[model samples]
Target: MKSKTKRLFLLLLSVIFVFNFNSIKGTAGKSVTKTVRVGYYQNEVFQEGASDKAVKSGYAYEYYRKLSEYTGWNYEYIYGDFVTVYNMLLNGDVDLVAGLAYTESRSHLISYPDKPQGTEQYSIVKHQGDDTITTNPTTLKGKSIGVLDSAIKVALENFLKEKNIAANVVTFSDYDALLEAFDKREVDTLAGESDGIYDRSHAETLYPFGETDYFICTSKDRPDLLKELNEAQSQLFLEYPDYISVLRNKYYPESLASRAFTSSEKEWLTSHESVAVGYLNNYLPYSDTTKDGKVTGLIKELVPYLFKQLGYETVAIEYVGFDTYDELVKAMDDEEIELAFPVGGGLFFSEEDGMFISKPVISTLTDLIYSTNYYDNSKQIFAVNESNKLQYYYIANHFPDATIEYYPSIDACLKAVLKGEATYTTLNGLRTASMLKKPDYEKLSFRQLGYADDMCFGVKIGNEGLLKLIDRGLSRAGTEYVNNLGSVYSDDMYKYTFKDVLRENFIGAFIVFLIILAILILLLLYSVRINRKRIREKEDAKREIEAVNQEKFVFLNKMNNYMREPINNIVSLIRISENMNDLTNIKNNLAKMGSFSKELTTILNNILNISSFESGQVKIDDSLSLYNFFGKRVLIVEDTLPNQTITSDIMKKAGMEVQIANDGLDAYEKVKAAPSGYFDAVLINVDDRNIQGYLFIKKIRDMENDIRSEVPVIAITADESESGKEKIIKSGMNGFITKPYDVKAILDKLSGIIL
Candidate 1:
């Protein structure tokens, strides 16, 4: 009986243990969604619209949403000013806060994850046009800098102390106030975090410094939450390694320089006394070798500029020119050329001829150049440069049935099209513009192919250190600098003088002059004989002839001025296109040429109305209203809803995309968000009740982004006084229109300015 009882007791204990184990497992399997309080403030991309419950969207906000997928955490956001929200997290009123850069002082009050979200760089900013100060710290020694009363102020103070530079640091309550003080000229400069959310459109970063990692912080009391958050973040990132980068790209279109050359890269640079770069000699406007063996192209200018950014001068570089890309590649393999320049980013380099590509220097769209007699061919034949695998593959994939003929270079490919040996050839659209300047290529018409290529520098595979240094230099130089370089080179190429026009047109103008002179001499001889026939009648007739002669001279002078003005403009454009070698500018000049041709036609039409000279003078009617604004986009800034509708309707009727902004502030934001050339024109309501339209336009004009900053603007107002008109012009507006939108007037003004 005793043995049976002991066995029963053991079985009971085992049953209880198994039941307990199953219950614990069930509890662990079920996910318990935890509610965490998150605190934030109104900072641009990091945390925007945080104060509003309806619209909470930003990088940090997106991060939390993504994190919830892993942690099953529900968040309740608490918003306040930056300091208030930070205090809330410290006091445990909120469990979490994001966008805090890790600092030793703050670490005591908060616990952070093992990995940071991203980085922020504090920088000094100035008016975009200000060149008084540079990246050199010495230039800022005595300048008064405006800074926010936040981490940015801390960074500025630290930077000042580190550089041993004494400058007055004025603090403001917030970013808006800080920028306001900067605009008022209360400070010589401004310092703030350099990020996408910052309004860089009107401000330029003088120099970036104090780069540090920012993290999502948890209250010290919530150590458990911190651990859970850390594990979830780790697993999340492990699954999608590019999660952070994807968020950044989605929220921030502009990138900041965050790279410094390592010791090895610097060593590589020092060891190389001179670097030889090979380029195709026929790639005009990009890189080309002159008859005298002098390199004169954008790539030639760019290489020196990039090197200068890395503290080296142009003397350290040598350019080697090749007629064919194959030759350039051969030079690279033989170590005769250390680098190949202006290489297409999509280019393929085989393992045997290994090469590394640097960051893109510039990107341009492609163009299809074809003979005017393309229809004469029964089958489409594409002429491709033998070394351009990108073009060859692109044509093969897009036109499977088409035949591709290989050529030695872009020049040869184009010539094939001109000779009718091929139906078409593709080249960089910008480069193609320079080619068309040749009179023979004029027989070939071209259009954009909706394709683009990034031009980069190529280095041998073994010289990765050099490639990294080049990439660092490119990053430091920045996109804005590269774009400016492109503009400068393009302008240089297209340069022309009044002397060129005079030389080209001298023969034609002289021939017309001789014909007019002969006609005048014959008329004088005929009048003299008529004068001698009658005496008193001769005197009256002579006086009458003199009056007619005076009228004729007046008419001729007026006609000459009107006709010659447009002719001079047309000739100037042609010469400029030849010199500039820029395709975009060529298109713009071509439009201008069309306008000039229309003006000439108007003058001719007026001449046909000779009967209008019955009043002893000729009257010319130069009014034209054949405006075709189809497919154009315009921004209409109007406060009143009805006015917005009316103006929008008018623009829409003309087949334009009419974007409306309720106020000047809204208009400024819209303009800031848009890409360059996105809007063909902007129409501002100058008498806006909220912000003055004149001030808004001035802000746009001061924008650092050249695309929208240089966009044409017209003001809408009730005031039609001469002073009001003068004010609009002085405010940097292209033109103005009185209130109560006139469709014809709007179309005409836009056509003249944009079209």
Candidate 2:
């Protein structure tokens, strides 16, 4: 009995020891409640109000509360305006203050943490749909910029001075006042911190600058408190690597509200109580109506939501359905409907058609539906629906040679192809996806046309105010919701049964069987005619080979003659120019020599191009056009006189002042003597026997003047392979143009490098 009592006592002592150990481990590296006086200010979204309210809410508030888990510090909040609170921190009234932008002057009296709490960046924001202001800093000239009287204002002034932009800086007491001035159109733009502007979905960031770290600052005398704060911050980061991002996301999630309307738009909205919206009744999954007259589809569902977001009552929208696009458009034109639904396009409605369009809600691919029997038609014929003008126009413009058969609808168009009246039809792959699954279209297949059909709303012309409101609402609806709504309406994939396939392809299969049987019967008689046919074929083959060889011989002969004439003319011109005493005539002859040299180069390049084609080694694109380099100057370095003349003439034709340097030393000396930016670009011949191209470019790159060293240099070479191109780039040349380059090729290369 005594031994059992001792065991029970030991068990109780062990439980008590375990509890104490856990308590110690839980409080490891944490202090008891140390009341730290924190200076707080209303820095919207970051911190707000005084005492308990400031400590309970905001990004900084959350950060401090999270930090307290480690530091075990309870904040004694001292509330005041921004300046008063900051001065309190300096005067030692408060131990620390959050949201102080770090500066050299602030660092003298206060100590900031080694790592910043967060970065505060400022931007110039303008109202959404304001087209007068732009991202260009110069656009701010003579404009009034509203700024909260804080560090953001100072940053704006610095930005103006640095960019040499002269603008009126209108200061307000707080962010609310600044935003009010902007909403009243008293200022063209407002400068605000990122956190302050994050929730204002109506404001567009015109220019972002003045990025600086905001720190939790403390007095220099309180090193011990600062150390504890810094250590706690480090511990918090170590525990949660994404703590800062989490706090920011929690506080500043993107707002779904649409931008407020302008005064004119508001007035227009007040006048119009309801809007008549029309849709194509047959365009499925995008726009359609039930037999009961209830409009239902992916985009139809989105329209009411858009109105709701735009602050318009959904009941005010009256939906009307039309069987055809033409009918819908007519209704819109006749004032029967104020807007049309689900107009598919890269452009929904053209201004030329007297209609305005809103932003697209969803986009789908365009595809060609063709018969499986004849993949390639001998005579191309496209079936287009009268309702789908986009498809008809695309077919007409892209395949002008193909014949088109008009139908009433996409269904009729596809049926015409099945009946063999038309070879194919183009359509939106998404809207007709359900029809494509049916047995009627099982024999048809889709080929992507590499075009997108962005479904959008359309309205009549002179209704831009309404259109603007629609666009604003659409923007607020967000892409995710629009895409998810589309997914919800997407039909499941239809699996075809064996019976369905057989029933659909019965007639075509039977016709194919007949053709196969006829071919088999014809095979029996083929042997009898084979011997005679082979004899004739042998003779024809011999004649064809002889004709091909003759053609080749003639082509080579013509090319040889063409090459000789240009060279002979160039030699004669050079000799004649040397003998001429008249300066004008000499210059004219030199120009003729340049032209002849260019012709000779073209012939040689053609020969190389032909060889490349036969070997399938290269294909030169000739679509590039010569870029204008008017008022620019260029230096041409070449040992060959003909090449120098050709390149110089090319540059001169491009309206550039050209200077010729025959040798590397002369070229180097001219560049060294010329002022910075004097020569726009330099063309160096890589095949120069005297000066190595790589070494010459290296010399230019190593010039004493920085601007001169970085002048655009283009290498001229015979090699066009990838390895050769890489080697040229590695040799310090900006870019390289191949030998025998035409005006387009040379100038395109020059413009890319120079510009």
Candidate 3:
């Protein structure tokens, strides 16, 4: 018994110590009372259908009553007008005050819950039959306006003064006193709380104005308690959603009540007030960009709605590159963007958002396209939008084993396939269909890759409130305004080029294929016909035709020979003229003789060649025979600065095209630049300076080379140098000139050199 007692005593001591330790840690049995002091006007609306009949059913009492039940704590109502509540909270006398507006000054006195439970609008109460002030609030300027002696009334007066509407503010004892004055027409526009106005609407005589929300005010000393109250208020909101629903309806009277947010969204709103979004620019046609570079399209219209409904005023849209669109979504695993519009991109690769797509998108239309050429290929690799995995699954179910590579934008996907880099790409059906109006329309044809789906801006899973807000705003903006922006950017984005639309379109392809087939058949037939015709022609009229051609060649050769000798001889004659006398003495006489000879020759050659060719006897054989050298001294002439360039190129191709002359004077310079006895050849155009080739050659021989100033120099010219040989040879040249020359005779005389 003694041992058992000792053991029991020790065990009891351990249990007691553990219990006391837990109590010291504020855990085991401690109940912390998070006091939320509810302070508002001791009015009927606040006390609601309830514990006190004096207070009517309104936000203050109804909200606090629900909050008390939610947090298992009672709110001690500090009933008063503005001063009693403000002073009580300011002096650390209470924890929270209701029916308050957020203010810059008030922000320092309290820590707000980051999001408004809702917004507050106002009503302007005035005396009945007061037509003057009802027209504009400006009539109140410098006029006495009765205000309840409250902080809100002070703020209202200050707001009116800042707007340049001055008012003589009179402090009334309570809302009842303010109402009584308004009935007497003693003040201008009377300011009333929206809730107060809403509450007073029940009374028969006094008129209530407009409607708005009233906020709960909290004290600086009890911030933790304020947070507890806020959390309790949140639970109250979940339990009695009608409280927020009524407020929502008052603000958006035309809007329908939306389903409340799940617990997750409610939790998110308590933490953050802004959202981050994303856009991918490359997906054209379906989704494209604007000039100032903001996103606009079916999806863009949805983002503003998402933000407003979630109570976020600011949005940061990340214009992420297409390659990184899905990567940004992976950040949602880390909550990088609370909500994003994976945007007007493909729907085959990134659809995790679809798993949670509680919101409805307006439309979805898609098409599949492939290379127009190489018809047998159906194994296609497609560029899918990797960000929307649900969308990816949605597409893959139809085309299993269809290799889908993730692409950031639809534009990138289309370009990849159009450029023959990828085998296939899918674009929106409406986007693809309307693109046919663009010039590039014929370049591709796409039936529905499948069907269209409604497109909405996506939110990372937890942002349900914002997603719903987007739906609301979109419904407000309507589809017509939404589709108009789509048309403009689409016209700008998927604008097709001439080649893009026309090249390899149906008609061109058929023509090209038929032409290839026809050519192949013609080649086979021509091969059989070629030999028989060749054999017969060789044995018969081939020789006769050859003879006729040979004769024509000889006849032209004779004509060239007849003219060559005299021009050469005349040039020789002129070379020795300097020996007899000065050129100044002989210039005019020589010029006359030379000019007369040239005129006679032009008339003759033109008559001969032009008549024969017109008579159809002359036919040119393009057959060229290669030879090693030509010995004739060829003189080449020009009236302007001539170049070694033509000479060098011809030398490489056929050994020195001809000698170059800069001007008639420079022709003489070229002769001067050559070595003594250097020129064995000469070919000259009549345009060679204004100086005559006759004069040039005469100068060449007179200048004296060791090869005998008399070496045969042949003149080639468009000009006809047609003097008789005796006089010409007697004067100085070896030749006249040939125009429209034969390649063979020119070579004959040139290579006729013996030594």
Better of 2 and 3 by TM-score: 2
Rank the candidate models, highest TM-score first. Answer: 1, 2, 3
lDDT of 1 by residue, 285-365 (tens): 667777798887777777787778766674378889987666777889899998887664354533434677787877777
Candidate 2: tens digits of C-alpha lDDT, residues 1-755: 99999999999999999999999999986757888989887766787666554335788887788878888788888887677777888899998888878777778989998778887778778877788777788888999988876667778899999999999999876555666687778988888776775556567776586888888888887998889988988888888988888887787654212244655577768788888888877666666777788887775678778878876764477888888777877888899988887664334235545577778877767788888776666878888888766576566656779888889878799888887888888877665577787777878888887766667788888887788888877777888898787666656323343321122233355346436534533442353245335546688576654553454345446666765786677667667866878876766666665566556555555544433332224332444334557779999998754456556755775678999887767787888899989999888887654756677788888877478888888888888899888988898888888865555676677778775
In angstroms, the error of model 3 at 371 is 5.0
- List of clashing residue pairs for candidate 1: 201-704, 493-579, 493-580, 494-579, 494-580
Range of the 10 consecutive residues with the lowest summed lDDT in candidate 2: 498-507
In model 1, the runs with Cα more than 4 Å from the true position are 1-87, 92-96, 99-243, 248-258, 313-315, 345-347, 350-353, 376-378, 385-402, 407-412, 437-443, 487-520, 524-546, 553-755
Q: Could you report the Cα RMSD, in angstroms, for every candidate shown?
A: 19.2, 31.5, 35.6
Per-candidate TM equals 0.46, 0.39, 0.29
lDDT of 2 at 371: 85
Worst 10 residues of 1 by lDDT: 611-620
lDDT of each: 0.73, 0.73, 0.53
| Better-scoring candidate (TM-score), 1 or 3 | 1
Instruction: Give the RMSD in angstroms, all C-alphas superposed, for model 3.
Output: 35.6
* Candidate 2, residue 716: lDDT: 83
Relative to the true structure, candidate 2 reaches a TM of 0.39
